[model samples]
Target: MSTLGGAGTPNPNKSFEVVQPPTDSISSLCFSPKGNYLVASSWDNQVRCWEVQKNGQNVGSVPKAVMSHDKPVLCSAWKDDGATVFSGGCDNIVKMWPLASGGQLVNVGAHDAPVKEVAWIPEINLLVSGSWDKTLRYWDLRQQTPVHTQQLPDRCYTLTVKHPLMVVGTADRNLIVFNLQNPQTEFKRISSPLKYQTRCVAAFPDQQGFLVGSIEGRVGVHHLDEAQSSKNFTFKCHREGNDIYSVNSLNFHPVHHTFVTAGSDGAFNFWDKDSKQRLKAMARCNQPIPCSAFNSDGSIYAYAACYDWHKGAENHNPQTAKNFIFLHLPQEAEVKGKPRLNTGRK
Candidate 1:
């Protein structure tokens, strides 16, 4: 097996728990808003929640609970109340889970194609989903139909919410911003900071801008405010030797303006935006790090270490690839960047 610190060998210097789950590959992972639980979606068509409350917990050790979809699960999010979970998959449907009621799967929404991203807008208690169908649908849990649907220029792949505004990245390198409070005006479309297709997007803690990742191993710091947008910039990440790897996920620390990124390079790195410096770089897996999430309290970070094998079926290696979830208690020495006011969520 690959052993990086290059192969990611188990060592004492390490500060994280490595978990092996009996699954294929992980597509997405998110932390519970209320507790130490983590919800993950996998290419195995399953969604599982693992508790990371420092009780010797790891991936396969009884995930608190597991749920399945008809096709590979792609994206997931938790409501602000932390009682309900939202999940979307290749089946083109988004399902709502009532965690307080024994994990009942309730079909809440659907799309014309595979749903690429979903997020909870707390101000309105709305669930918004974007699909390859080139549309964004807004849904209210009390109703079965969407409250409104907006068309996009191309397939929507990445999405982020920031209360007053939201951003959606679509095919053709398009980044569209919608004013949450003033929907009557035309949506604002901006040139994507990256040239490749968007892989992930996260709203900045300050709401002055956001982070956007691409399949081309690059990330762009974008500012929504006119004067600040000109100051935006991009950087490269997830490259090993000469291979270009996809940046699968990006998340900003709840309190720290700094952020973390996971990539197909089989690693994740922490960064400080203001200083433009890397806080930490971890080479801890043999497969891609598809997703990573921070807990509500920001005391812990959970990540999925697995082979997305997203290149194609021909590139998959079942014997060599193992599925896992890792939880790390980041020390101040490892990730404490300059602290800033914590924004609620995206």
Candidate 2:
């Protein structure tokens, strides 16, 4: 395939621009709901927002702002409207930044330990955060007190939310699913199908179930209805020479139900959830990808290639640790294929 930006054949060699912020490794990257901006948070204790060219102009590194946190900001999320942002970090604090009111963080809530993830649900006007403290806390932007809190069996590792359904994956290999209508109650609980630590979870676009990734390069496709879950299966990726990489991140395409995955092996891949077939895999990257996301409109896909401290010391280099954000204009074929045949699902 030609490497230039054309149709579904995007030129991989030419990036919109390269970013080298965050003296330490980048932890996450998320595009604004507007699709014209992206924000990244890092271990360096700063969150940088970059301007993205939606019109396909010759782009360069255009950073809009730098916000500070006391410790590594593990996650950054944009609200449904795209003007406000939420961040949580190792300092156990969750903050809200209003772009229109002058980019100042309002201390919203805190966890007992490092905050691992933050997810915003516009439907309920609610924000949910998970932590190593082994609990999930719900917050209302209009109030300082948490709306509700639910304790988990172990440290909360990953959270996946799709409208009325929310799923939490924790350190105890517990998979907890909840109905968002009643935030504090648990809907179902099951042991993780994977043998290793939970690395990531992404809800299916239709909310049928979710995809789970682990440190052992394994991914499990699950369905809420066990009858439909007969097709629930596990696959492996991120395996390089003599090493198995953690499946670091997963995002489902909005228009197409297919999903994209990134891993510690410094790789990104596209897959069809129904047919259980991989559509494409990018060239191996120079650093592990910690997180990835797609804009609400699905025109752009973004990912952060940075060092992961949790990987221990085997394959990381402090000298080479970077804050590399990648942008790709995914063609229809690369992200989606023809409608997968049902082959007669009962």
Candidate 3:
């Protein structure tokens, strides 16, 4: 419900608001690569797109489009060039949309089971989708059929493409990095050190490495170019009692070398990728945050689908705290030659 700037502080001077869809959990949210608009999907089986105005205003107009699905829409991603968008839902299908217009959904069948993740790779005009059917399918927008499909050992929850490579995370806590440059070869699967389910995965913008989040409140950072013997940097995130019911969403900053994560405990934390340190912990929510994304300028924004009753829920009421975007600004540094007060008595 907010956007934070590079410094990880909430920007009070600027903000934007989107009309909240019907009461349902937000399954996914995405910012267009151009940063002029945003799309949010919910368990209510709706996808709503909004136009972002200057100074953080949502324009108060109706959504560009409100697409419907048979089941909850789970995830969404925009093409690198912002020409198209891809979305998946519980209906077990991946759909493509034209961004120039108000996103008209196009059916692209890939799995017999519910599709869990959908990612658009603008570099090659390809779309990668994962599903509960235990498979990853690659689609060429120019063709009506999937170009290739890889059967996985377990249900794949998340997927991302880094040019000639694609990364897939499974429910079994395994991470597989595939070299698409040689599509004829098998994928290089790497078993992560995570003990529980791998809930989410995000590749660095530069594609040097990727991070994986688990149900046990842990985040593991893996390097792609390093030797297999190299150790992954792991960090415990939430409280002991607040074990991650779901590490559902993750996003990298557009400018800063940091990333953000949200979990079922309703907590969102920003971490420095190079240092592997937690930079800031935003306000915890009453319900789990299903999805989040950053703007083109590195502003952080997130949406939560409240499912539980707690203190965080009280503060997040639609009537009182209904802003859909949080703006975080860098705190100004104090001048070095500033005047100082003296405690000496005359």
What do the candidate models score in CA lDDT, each in turn? Answer: 0.79, 0.81, 0.67
Better of 1 and 3 by lDDT: 1
Error of 3 at 116 (Å): 0.8
The weakest ten consecutive residues by lDDT in model 2 span 1-10
Best by lDDT: 2
The residue pairs that clash in candidate 1, if any, are 3-6, 3-7, 3-8, 4-7, 4-8
lDDT of 2 by residue, 1-346 (tens): 2111112312243445445566777888888876577888888788788777666645455777878889989988889888888999999999988864566789989999999899999999989999999989999888888988899999999998998889999996899999898877899999999998998999887888999999999899999997897889999888866778899999999888789988876778988977778998887665667888887777778876666766465655557444567776777887885576876967
Instruction: List, residue by residue over 228-308, the lDDT tens digit for candidate 3.
Output: 426467888865363435566677766664777777666677777555456677666544555677667754354543442
Better of 1 and 3 by TM-score: 1
lDDT of candidate model 1 versus the reference: 0.79
Candidate 1 runs further than 4 Å off = 1-22, 55-62, 183-186, 338-346
